[model samples]
Target: MIRTLLVGGAGRMGQALGEGLSALSSVDVVGLVDPHEPARLFSAPHFRSLEDVSVAVDAVVDFSRPDSVVLSADWCASHGAGLVVGTTGLSDEQRSRLERAGESVGVILAANFSLGAVLSERFAAMAAPFFDRVEIVELHHDGKVDAPSGTSLVTARAIREARERAGRVTAPEPTERFTLESARGADAGGGVRIHSVRLPGLVAHQEILFGGPGEGLTIRHDSFDRQSFVQGVALALAHVNDQPGFFSGIDHLIG
Candidate 1:
């Protein structure tokens, strides 16, 4: 069994992971690292910080804030634990830390831990070179703190890379004048425009639109519940230790 420590034990995603993992015989919730210490979903020990935990675990699943990223890699290395990180909106410095940490221990960092989302990104990239212009719209619950969603960023990056491989430049842009400033969504490099929508009823949804003369294509993915993320998380936890480097997407793990 994998002795696992949940870094954001009390958060929504963390709780979901705990509930799902508890049902499986492959993983045991050895410890929880969260400051709030929300209602217990399991009988695991709770620590306000990973630094405070005395128990040793084989792996850590981090779904916490970007700030918590400061110690994640080092914590994993010091504790001899493999790490599966799903935190987004990371700064350049934090990314660098992950790269360094991967050299010492196994690490898998991904924007979204949903299999459907990863497949959607892959399909979008495959279709990118054929389209003249593309736009992405991402919607999430109002409680989400990040804009454009990390999945959208990952999709944009994949599209850009595909275009580069196809010997294509950035997608075409509209020449019309904007009546309102910032009317167009923010350009996320490679001429990909991203629109972020946050409202109460959304539980993670993204649409990618590809346009060419007289034809268009739309690819979309929706995560209706938190459980949509469980399988991917579990898969990452199971395979992380086998690879001793930082992988940026779920594609590499499942593939």
Candidate 2:
């Protein structure tokens, strides 16, 4: 029946997920674990901590902070349950903990779960090898805690991987010398540059530009609402149990 527990269920994303789950027929939201007050949209069991829950759930879907996410991973591992993580901005050590938990249970750790964002990442990777230079710009709401936004990082990584597969030792760099130290954006894995913008009006948006000799290709995705992420979360929840080890990104879920 896919008994799923929603972590961080009081947040915006969590509320959207609860609505999605309620509409689905195959999955049941068994409970919600969040330090905040009970989710106003959901009438399920509410828990301040996983330790307080006496019932056993088949899987956990996490949309919490980095610290709480690690603890949720541990809870899933100890209970032999599947875990789907949508939290971003985790430290390297925290990410490693989630990976290690997969030894005892299935884990799906994704930076961004919107289907458009997922597809944009794949498209950028596929076109990266043919381009001479690539850059990314990601915009998010100011309240977002992450700088680069998880979608940009994922897309940059995919772009870098594509170049590597093409036997390119390094990504093409900008020719202009930067007079200002902070003029250039942060370098993601594989030498891909990422520019992050956080403002009040923006929800989430990312643009990937691949430039060649005289042509350019641009892939873009916009997530105006948190509901866009729910379908991807549903997909991950349904398939996480089938995969035994740790998996990153929703690319595998689609392609």
Candidate lDDT values, in order: 0.88, 0.86
- Pick the lDDT winner: 1
Q: How many residue pairs of model 1 clash at the backbone?
A: 0
Count of clashes, each model: 0, 0
Model 1 agreement with the true structure over 86-144: per-residue lDDT tens digits: 98998999988888889878888988888999999999999999988899999999989
Which parts of model 2 are misplaced by more than 4 Å?
A: 39-41, 169-172, 175-179, 189-191
- Distance from true location, Cα of 241 in model 2, Å: 1.6
Q: Lowest-lDDT window of 10 residues in candidate 2?
A: 167-176
lDDT of 1 at 149: 87
Which regions of candidate 1 are displaced past 4 Å?
A: 169-171
Candidate 1 lDDT for residue 238: 91
